[model samples]
Target: MPNLNFEFTEEFALKMDQNDPLRSYRDQFYFPKVNGRDALYFCGNSLGLQPKSVKTYLEKELENWANLAVDGHFEGEDAWMYVRQKSKPALAQILGAHPHEVVAMNNLTSNLHFLLVSFYQPKGERTKILCEAGAFPSDQYALESQVKFHGLDPEETIVELAPRAGEHILRTEDILAKVKEIGSSLALVMMGGIQYYSGQLFDMKDITAAAHGVGAYCGFDLAHAAGNAPLKLHNWGVDFATWCSYKYLNSGPGNISGIFVHERFADDQSLPRFAGWWGHDEGQRFLMEKGFIPMHGADGWQLANSNILALAAHQASLDLFAQAGMEQLRAKSEKLTGYLEFLIDEISGNSGILEIITPRTASERGCQLSLLIHKGGKAVFDSWYAHGVVGDWRNPNVIRLAPTPMYNSFLDVYRFGKILEQSLHDFA
Candidate 1:
């Protein structure tokens, strides 16, 4: 593709959208309406649009539930016993992990808790947990509860790495230095694969390697990064990770989440985990003996029988992911986001009302561009929404716009820029 002019002009946006290969994918999602018009939704970083195929996939499950009843667990066209397995390949393709290394199960936070129970054993001096400060509130809550559960003081056992004064992004050097300083006291180091508010993509390989150098386990909450970035969790030596499918994955709200356990730890039965019958050996699971025999590998982490309907709905979105491929999706993503950045910069030139807080380097960030409005505040952002622009607003002053390449068109970004300009003028 040629360089896109930074002018917020319809002709330029239309031409770019016309040339976009992934443009057709936009029709696959259901965009909510504001007032008889399709809302320019840029909030896929929070909740993704529903895939058209999702309802069809879910309807099949509902029909089977209605007709087949309890027998559907073993007799449906897609056996529920093996329903989770069906999603394994498709999910592995997106995550760059082997099918055996990934399992689609409970929601993201619940899996985080499950993984913590198994991985976060604080012994001797190695009882500290280091994480990014200002992580998602749910993560903070879970981390605090976990620390308290271990009878450790949250202040002493939990260390939060934060940005420097007046800065909005964390530096890798500072994080590494902190990890080394904590050294033996650190039991586990976990962080968001991408910062939720700042939109900075952390260097997972380096972070994990740093933690491992000190004999600490490293993991990630991939809620924002899963489908938005190319993740090589296995290759990066990520001990374990969890992510929800709703955001960039296009699975509906509260969709089934997934977990990744490194192949190295797959056979480590000595590791402690709170297991259930569903994790028991499938070959003899029906025997229902008193002993708990977990299936080998990531499946062993499962605590209950898979939700077949949720798995099917997630599978529908995964099919689209496999079809588009992450590399291509990311390629278009960078360009589309770069285009949005350029347009924003163009419109804000000399205005000094909006500041882009996300990293300027494409390699250091995802598709999201967090705009910190200077003079204008939430009132200005609200006016943009009034005109059908549907980005998200963080507390205080940040407006997050994510141009998801899989389902968002360049025209949408262009229209957002235009509306934002009008909003600024009106607010002024």
Candidate 2:
């Protein structure tokens, strides 16, 4: 790779921004203004800024509700029952999944629980669950609860894989080894697609194959991975996956989440699920029959009526995603994020004030870079916020900066580097 330090200059950064094919995408979002200027936001890994068109989408629903009342479900311009269907192709394009394999439904954790109810079949000797050691809290909680619900002891039935001592990232070889050793007794193998803290993109293809070879079901929590990286859930043979849209998806906070069930399990009517009216077959839905008949694909997994307003907001974001193809977005992301890494490495040299815990390789990580502040810790990070550079601090000493390809630019990375330099100098 070319030297990142020499490649970024004021003139060069400005020129790159000018020639950027995706530069117009910035206009779609609404960023917070600070001190009469738009703040430099690098927290897309946590909460993405809302799209400008979202308000219009919400207003349309409000108007329908006012004019039609209960009749709006069937008579509105965008019928509520069919609203999710509109977003399927767009979301499917982003995830590299077929439209029939994906569904828009409940929030991330709820979907995870629903999926586990059907996929995590722990019987006899194959009753242990395997996951990364420091998974997102919600995932950890879901696993523990699932084990408890099955009347099993979590301490005995849950196995967590940790990185080697003195290392922050887990090696693929180590993970495979552990899976092989515990193969026969493992009931489920699930992990975050990209680790939230370290930003390491786990090898899903390898892991899924191993899990299947051992007769275990494999799933993924794509909370931080979905739109931030390229994914082919179907081709990878993952049993199931779920993701929130607020992060790299650029949907607003608490926006609708999505779930994917490979075609292999689509018609497995034998699988047990916590069913609801929404999951019932749409053709016979009005029949109010005693027995439930699920839709042939992912739509069959829905449990209740969806929140159409949130789905509308999600559509606005997905429209933008579709316009900017994921492959193109990912290409720009590699260069933009690589530029960020270059800037930080230059400024932090010999100061020993910070260290990047996220992996260095472009292929091994996503957009977020976790900075381990070595000097003033949280105090130093808070000062950066006071200076109008917005990023997230995750306990102890880490500040995460996610330079999203859709909105963030090379200049933003350069400005953040200057701010970080000043903060470190002041602390010394």
Candidate 3:
């Protein structure tokens, strides 16, 4: 964590922004307007602001489609047939995996089902899957359905772990102990890289190790952690993982999702998978082959051709990530979120109306700070929205604010503090 004395003043924020190395990147994005002004956007965790370059990127594909028509698949430099490769290097860097280990494909939930077919092979007594309770609802539904598809009762086959008592976050030790207790019965250990509601980043490497120790396959739904947190999925020895590109990656809404499969599975043709023509060997794909000779790596998971326009928009943001680098972005993220935490603590003082439920330690969280509101929660959130503050309110009492390092600045956080202070007063 970069330790710097934080002050709750406008001038101090101005100074911090003026000195920020990543400040210029903020201008590269288009912010939504509220009340004739650019809104303070702290909702990147839900949906990211569009990159200015997305227009040009999309137009390029549209031109290729209009000009080349059928030839566009193999004609120009950015051929539609192989466009997925363009984002590989940047995706590899973001995921900390070999290029062959990761590939952009179907949506998050769809990919999860595909991966479960390959990894969640329950045999004999080893028929259990462990995951966090209250995972994103889609994951819950997918897991439940997958277990049911295998003729197992979800209540008996899937274990959902929750934070103990009133705690909002799971301790790493408790997770490991649970893995040990499950022992050989656990066929899979599936979890989110970061808990969506609590904004807690899990110890994925440790969890993976513990799962392997118990002879179970480990994977993660990295929808919240993908570009926001530092991940070395290859080094962690994780068997499989998947994430959507729309949130922290700033791709358009419901854009493509990427998956990582360890190199150890690269040539394992014996593993059962839901095969498709796109997953077959590229050289033999057009031959109208009768057999499914899977591609050597993560590419083997693809079920269909890439969405050219989506990939174009996705590449626009990935190109920015390649230039900016994840390490530098993560450094700024810590400072931005830390400053937000500091200001929240300072303003909340003895007011018992709001509390930050996100983990305080920098390494244990990303940019999002989930606020647990005790009084006037909805009214306070509405006030912030009316006043040009853009954040998301979860059901019950939490408001999620993500200060993205790519486009958000210290000034944004400072302004949000003023809005929050006033909203609290008005609502109280």
Clashes of each: 0, 0, 0
Question: Against the hidden reference, what TM-scores do the models get?
Answer: 0.97, 0.98, 0.99
Ranking by TM-score: 3, 2, 1
Model 1 C-alpha lDDT per residue in residues 39-69, reported as the tens digit of each score: 9999999899999999899999999889988
The Cα error of candidate 1 at residue 89, in Å, is 1.4
Candidate 1 Cα RMSD after full superposition onto the native fold (Å): 1.5
TM-score of 1: 0.97
- lDDT per residue for candidate 3 within 1-428, as digits (tens), equals 54489999999899989988889899999999999999999999999889999999999999999999999999998988888889999999999999999999989999999999999999999999999999999899999999999999999999999999999999999999999999999999999999999999999999999999999999999999988999999999999999999999999999999999999999898889999988999998999969899998999989899999999999999999999999999999999999999999888887888989999999999999999999896888898999999999999999999999999999999999898788767766
Per-residue lDDT, model 2, residue 48, is 89
Off by over 4 Å in 2: 1-6
lDDT of each: 0.89, 0.89, 0.94
lDDT accuracy of residue 367 in candidate 3: 98
Estimate, for each residue in 275-313, the C-alpha lDDT of model 2 and write its tens digit. 999999999999998899898788899988989888888
